[model samples]
Target: MTTGRLLIVMNAGAGHSQAEASRAAIRAVLDAHGRAYQFFLADSGSALPQQAALAVQQALAEGGAVIAAGGDGTLNTVAQAVLPHSLPFGVLPLGTFNYFARAHGMPEDIKAATEALLSARIQPVQVGLLNERIFLVNASLGLYPTLLEDREAYKAQYGRSRLVALWAGLVTLWRARGRLRIVLEHDGQRSKLRTSMLFVGNNALQLAQLGLPSAQQVEQGALAALALRRTGLFTVLLLLLRGAIGQLHTADKVLHFTFQRISVRPRLPYGRRRIKVATDGEVGWMSSPLVFAVAPQPLLLLCPATMETPA
Candidate 1:
């Protein structure tokens, strides 16, 4: 049970049309649990990271836990605040894809998640950093980030759905051109490669799909990196075929590896020393050369008492 007041920072746009209903359900569950908590509904138009940071500061001052009530992106914003202070954090998975919540063994249903939070146990979970920005899932450069950019626009115009996302990916792949030249340094080794895509995995499920053995234990304080080794049209087609058949890791043109930290630099740098990067489905620009590392201190995530950390 929450020993002190719990601060909840909710994103107004997270649940879309059902945002209100979700909020009511959360309130009812918390009240039934007799938890002392305060609510802060983040303005949809305001900068979420800033708003969440302020809310986190308030929660720390009140000597309580902070709960992020929304999808992975919303959780990421709240995490930015909690991480600096090394505060305990909770999550309410009210999103289309509850990747981070599911990774932590959080139930999808709101009432169930609430109950889990009430009798929660704190676990230190690893988080990945891109130029020091925390990301709970994966980060990517090249074709994948390009696909994310397309998917966001498509979702805006046609609404979000699995079918819509697939359509967006196809459209993006058809239009993508050329290869990326990057210098990647892992451990004490460094190499220059030309490829169409690169992905750094922090989520176990995604890593498993890429056939990495480390997917079984994501919190082992490491990262799985995947890169397409060839950029030719035929190589791209072969990678797509292998991916469709669940043989991506076995494909000759794909490189899959694990690391505790890595750095990436683009051959053609952007002005102002910045480069485009995507993490946990959110895209932004960060200063180059992008350095990714596993945080030294794991995040204190509140999970169900019965939940076991994934192995």
Candidate 2:
């Protein structure tokens, strides 16, 4: 490990007040531990992935550790830069959900999370690939992607909150229509299906919470895919209710599969070259016939040594 300062790449606009407090808390913890660090804040005008990639390069060149300090979206952006070099990845867990960090046994509190970083152990963690990009949690297409879009718009207009996000989802489901007709090719066989939502989870604990099959260790080096067969608003509502109650995997309309890699494409040929996709709470565009795969190697994550598997 480098004796230099830790390099922290943070998204300036996310959770402004919380981020400020967390930054102070981080300073306090690192100072008490006698560690040094530097900050790289991503501004509104900066292209995030590009800036983060540059920061990663600079950090690696200086023989320092790089930490991502924001939500899953920010973490995913940073991961894109770190994965290529196989650098040690650290997390500050300043995001809304903090799924990736929390799933890896990172505490949500700013001070504790920073302590975890100071006493970190390098552990191998699996990451999922959506098209050419990396996703730490899960990715989805069709209605779920559209729902994420709506949620973001709603948050931007009405201010973000858990209840507001839930309202946005309800409004989206009320107006939702159309099922994506596509073929899923896995293991030498292809299945034709029409569904409103699809979710690919990298964390097995998250899958198990949704009533799906999952191993005790999410680092098992595989991905889990969930498909919903119905597009009706009421059915979607019912499924959401079941998910809220932890019965989604047992629902008759849902299908689950585990795989090393899978391919998805529209059944009908189209002139368009790309489709809107969502991964780890961020939305973007990708070319058709999107291929999702698990990287053969694991990311070196800075996790606490005493922290066990996800509960």
lDDT by residue (1-311, candidate 1, tens digit) is 45777788887765456778887888898898788888777767246777777777887788789889887778887887898887889999986678889978899898889878988988878888888888888888878888888997998899767789878888887888858888998878899998888888898866666566768656566888888886676677777777766678777788878788889987774445676778888887777788888877778888888877632
TM-score of 1: 0.92
Instruction: Give the lowest summed-lDDT range of ten residues in model 1.
Output: 267-276
TM-score of each: 0.92, 0.93
**Residue lDDT tens for model 2, 1-311:** 33556888887766567668878888888888899888777774146777677778877788777888887888888888898887888988876668889888999888888887887877878889987888899998888788888998898888767788899999999988867788899999999988877788897656766767653435567788888896588888898888887788778888878888999996544678787789889888888898989976677788887865421
Cα RMSD to native, each candidate? 2.2, 2.2
lDDT values, one for every candidate: 0.80, 0.80
Cα lDDT for residue 68, model 2? 89
